[model samples]
Target: MIWQLDLIILVLVIVCAIAAINVKDLLSAAILLGAYSFLLCLLWAIMGAVDVAFTEATVGAGVSTVFCVSAVFHTTRRTTD
Candidate 1:
């Protein structure tokens, strides 16, 4: 695995995480978190951690994101700040 590629992925993951935190919309933040998980999964795969990557894909990206969205659906989307 190329360190340059790993660095790129790390940068992307950081960016997505920050974006997810800063975004006021709950659904959008959840989606961004999913994207961050996806990039982390890719990084793990490239580092030869296939099992960990699969877990991230399924649990982090799939289940958690879905749960977040569902929770958002049941809550108000208004931004008070």
Candidate 2:
């Protein structure tokens, strides 16, 4: 049962990571990255590493994502040819 949940979360993390890299829109990529970070935090929490999970949730998913989105907002969303 627990392994199934871990597998699902792992798959989602991989998908988010791939989407984050392939996304054309900066905002979308930033959001995907945040999702990936959140999934990682969840994975850590599930693995019983509360300290790491909290740090990743606060730093990776929270602060880093906010910074990325802010940068995206201030700059161009589209990539130049």
Please, what is the TM-score per model?
0.93, 0.92
Off by over 4 Å in 2: none
lDDT tens readout by residue for model 2, 1-81: 278889999999999989898988889999999999999999998899999999999998999999999999998899642
Computed on alpha carbons, the lDDT of every model, listed in order, comes to 0.91, 0.92
Report the lDDT tens digits of candidate 1 across residue range 1-81: 889999999999999999988888878888999999999999999999999999999998899999988988999665543
- Given candidate 2, what's the lDDT at residue 69? 94
Candidate with top TM-score is: 1
Clashing pairs in 2: none
RMSD of 1: 1.1
Best by lDDT: 2
Q: Global CA lDDT of candidate 1, please? A: 0.91
